[model samples]
Target: MTALAATSTPSQDLPSLIERAASMLSGAKTAAEVLEAREVAGLAYDVAKRAARLQRAKSAHDDLVAAAHRAQAHALEIEARAKRRLADEYDAAQARGEVAGHGGGRNFKVANGNVETTTADLGLRRDQIHEARQLRDAEAVDPGIVRRTLDERLEHGEEPSRAALRKMVVDAAMRGMRPQRRASRRNPLYVAPTPEQAAWRHVTGVFRAFAEWASDENLALARKGMREAGDTPFHDLDARAIAQGSAAFTTIKEWFDAR
Candidate 1:
């Protein structure tokens, strides 16, 4: 009991000393124990702080990984948009090439599903108009033929310009037949007024003055009266007789009034 045990080496006794200290600190209650527990608690607090720092670092790493995934997704979307744009440009170029391959004359199918050449259609219409105009111009005959047809129509009560009439004329000409002279007929009149009688109304009072003067009577007034009578074809001889001074002015006036 009196002999003391030899102290163990510091390195060899470290684990045992730490174990005892931990137990003491765990059970500490008094002032000295509380002070020792405080130191132990401070060390434990430092350990907890280090553990919290590690946890926060791991959380930050997880957050960075999620952000990286989102960034990659955004990059993929950008790439997809660029690819679509490129495809659109390529399609547009291909369409342009196809359009260019066709010459200036592009083919179009009509509603009837038939293909027709535009130029040929226009030419056909032009030809139709030309033919119609030629037909009209060709049918326009000489005026001399029209005039003869009109005269024949009036004298014979014939419907002229008939093909039968044309053939008859042609046949007669071929046979050297002489066309007979058509007679001009006169209408009968019940009473034929003398020229001096017809012109009596046309005689001027100025001519009466000339007749009263005898030789001094106005020749000008007599000539004017004759002109007035001659203006009308319905009376003739009486006007000339009055102008020549063959009929008495009073007789001419009476004949004119009677008419």
Candidate 2:
């Protein structure tokens, strides 16, 4: 036997060993060879069971991580919304002189033992929002580090299954969570077409005009010509195809006009 076959653990080479044992059983003529094959096959079964248990453990860990992340994000969102609502309420109270200082301007007293003035309550809410945001941003898993670790594991002859490899790649490509920015309170405005959009519109408009001017027979011919050029109505043609189609339609129109 080679060094690899000698050093390989049953878990790592279970499938190959199983196949070899099956082959040996098929070729066995003596009782001793047949008994050896049976022992190897039984060992392969144990290795397979161990591999499955490891896979299940890995899957459970991943599911727990995913659930933790989702819960963190949901808590952050709720905290942010609560903070905004509290700020709005504080501003409204101040505007109506319900939360003003006892003597004059902005000073206010704490109300109940557990609660305070609107300003102080708002401040507390803001602090809570900041803490929650930080907690949400703190990720336990570093995808880049995970990818490197995966590579090192594979290099050491610890082979991860295909599903595990896919998960590792996906995790490495995922971006870290951060606090979402509040949407700007700006009025919507109409925007003009971009230069690329304008050019494409011009090309398509030329084709449309030709289609409108062409006779029925010529219009049918134009459709056939575009189809022959590999253009499909269900999909938008590329710029080159658009230019070619426009030129073809224009020629067809001119031919019908001359007639």
Task: Assess each prediction's global lDDT (C-alpha) against the native.
Answer: 0.35, 0.42
- Give one digit per residue, the lDDT tens place, for model 1 in 1-259: 1001122333323223223333544464332332343333223323333433554567766433332222222222222222223223223433545212222232212223354323232122334333322222221211123234434543453322224334543554455443222332353434444546534423554465445755634666767755764543212324443465655656767777999
**Number of backbone-clashing residue pairs for each candidate, in the order shown:** 5, 0
Model 2, runs deviating above 4 Å: 1-60, 100-118, 121-259
Q: List the residue pairs that clash in candidate 2.
A: none
Candidate 1: worst-modelled 10 consecutive residues by lDDT = 1-10
Q: TM-scores of the models, in the given order?
A: 0.16, 0.22
Q: Which ten residues in a row have the lowest lDDT in candidate 2?
A: 135-144
Model 2 lDDT, full chain set: 0.42
Root-mean-square deviation of each candidate, in angstroms? 64.1, 26.8
Backbone clash pairs in model 1 (N, Cα, C under 3 Å; residues 3+ apart or in different chains), count: 5
Cα displacement (Å) at residue 234, model 2: 40
Best by lDDT: 2
In candidate 2, position 43 carries an lDDT of 50
Off by over 4 Å in 1: 1-60, 98-259
